[model samples]
Target: MWKNKHITFFITGGIAVYKVVELIRTFQKAGAEIRVAMTKTAMQFVGKSTFQTISKHPVQTDLFDQTTSAAVAHVELADWTDLAIVAPATANIMSKMANGMADDFVSTTLLALSVPVIVVPAMNVHMWNNAATQRNIQTLRNDNIQVMDPDNGPLAEGYSGKGRFPSNDEIFNYIVEQTEDVDNSKLAKLRGKKVLITAGGTREYIDPVRYISNKSSGKMGYALAKVAQENGAVVTLISANVKLPIPAGIDVIQVETVEELAQAVQTQFVSTDVFIMAAAVSDYRPVHFVDHKIKKSADSANLTLELEETTDILKSLKSRRTKQIVVGFAAETNDLLNNAKKKLDSKGADIIVANDVSQSDIGFGSEDNAVTILQHNATNIKVAKANKQIIAKKVLEVIVKRLS
Candidate 1:
């Protein structure tokens, strides 16, 4: 999809730096020119000559080297390209970009560039979780920088959780979107589908002043709704109790409790071609809501609010389904795969997005989602921890494939 585009490719220090050579070649073969910039530490893993030879352009690695900047390097490079992409972004580089630190040439160019930037993070599992590293990543996203998630696989450390970089093709897809000036017709899979998505966490009131809810930011669900609308689907978003700003170009049904969500889902189910239950619905609610918040008294050692099971919205509506695809999510702390499989069958979901939350990499309120899409007798797709927009796009692909 990328043709006649100029891409500013930034290479950072990581074991995955070798992959960038292939990434550069792929873009070149697709009819594009590339400018290469490498971090000081990146040179330790791969030779500067490797990228220079493939790009047929001398690499830029210095911030103050007049020999390179004699051409007004950073400004020229930043202004000449459509977008900049940093592959194998190390924890060190992530921190630099997040905090607006321009100590290095690559990061300095990144801060100066205004078009668009995509950061492909690659680092050790431990480093990915370090408090300092996470803060930086969040900062980058908030700054409107798109980050491609590193796939979970065997790391150079011989350990595996979620710290491997995505394949070259995956990175190329993103580059094409940001840099290339072309549109593909494959985005019309949802042309006539009536899609409904529920987002955020529903609240069950314990009292007039208190309630029970989960930490769902509504980002994933909102993104799903947005993508559906972009693909020509008539989308309806059943939003719950969150302060999230819903995207334009879709209908929104606001709900607060399980009763409201269940009612909304049932009302929309018959006409909906794809039902995405993305809301974190409360499993239980107070048997009786107190009009006033409970008071603390020394004489009362304990206070218990009776609980009642909420409606099984998914299972209850299976008979109401009419050529519609149903999807659900299982956010778990332990026994992830097994629990997800059970929910998939019992809830009658076409696909169950199962995610592990105990590790804290993703789940609940995180912007990134690491999920295993279990479908059709356990055919699974293990998606990495990346931006929710990317995850939503992939999820929609599954729905589209199933529908077709």
Candidate 2:
């Protein structure tokens, strides 16, 4: 999406500065011409040579460097840039930029920029929440600079809070939204709508140490959440125990068991305009809960435990739903279309996305997926094998058509 674009990266000193390397590599892989400008403090955390090697361009670090023949280095760079990104934007640098201070190369070049500037703040939790920093951030926002909120997680200070840097995927999606020439109306198709998505596989515990769960890795669900957020929907994600990072700007509820997932969905279902049940919930669970671990018996060769059916969460919400459009997923080994159509009716879902899980390549923990989307009174749309991100856009496109 960044094909042939000239992108300028302004790095400021922070522990999170290390993450900017991956972001730079991603932009470079997307065919962007990247130039990096780093503050003196930023160089303390990451060497200028690292940026030079990755971006394949000379790192800009000084306003008085005689290395280049350009009349004014900062202005020349500012003119060359199509978009400027200030990642790991420290509190100090943010204050400088807010007050129009240009003591360093990063600030000087930013001050001379004509293109839109995106500022991603990274700082200690207390520093981020400080009154002065908040004021400066507000000032930057008021000046039409795009300031993305830092994520909440463990920081370098051995503490956890809302001061961590956002994931590369989150930043990449934001850049795509800003730079892509996609149809504005299509981009905002879900404007003012609420989307609730459930992802990952729910675990049914046999004991404290062991549980039965599917191989769902939550990639599809996360993709849907991202695509929905980019389409202007207020998104809430009910995620199971998956190792994936949460997409920025979405409310996430973590759950382990099917019962917990069901309750979480019920709480959000009323206000949701669109609900996608992408979670791979266990169909049955152990009927008896053993407080202690079961030991091997000397006489018995095998042990038997009763199992009970789990609640059909989607079907249970069928009669209670109002204007909401519900979607369900069917991971079938056979009769994929017929079973998906059956599920479409039985679950009272507006759409049923069916994929053959028997395939070793495309389903269950795979980065790519192919699915047949079945809807009432509409022909099934079969999406070919592709990355989950692409499939997500296709799914949202169909939903937009249905909602229209």
Q: Which candidate is the best by TM-score?
A: 1
**Could you tally the backbone clashes for each prediction?**
0, 0
Residue 378 local lDDT, model 1:
50
Measured by lDDT, the strongest candidate is 2
lDDT of 2: 0.87
lDDT of 1 by residue, 235-287 (tens): 99999986877688889999999899999998999998899998888999999
lDDT of each residue in 1-404, candidate 2, tens digit only: 56556789999898888899999999999988899999888889999999999988899998887444345667667756768999989999889989999887888889987677899989889999999999999999999888999999998999899889999999988877765764323335787799999999999888787777899999999999997886679999999998998898999999999999999999999999899999999999999878777788999989897999999999999888999989899999999999998899888999999999898777799987888999988888987676677578778877887785
User: TM-score for each prediction?
Assistant: 0.58, 0.57
* Candidate 2: regions farther than 4 A off: 1-182, 185-187
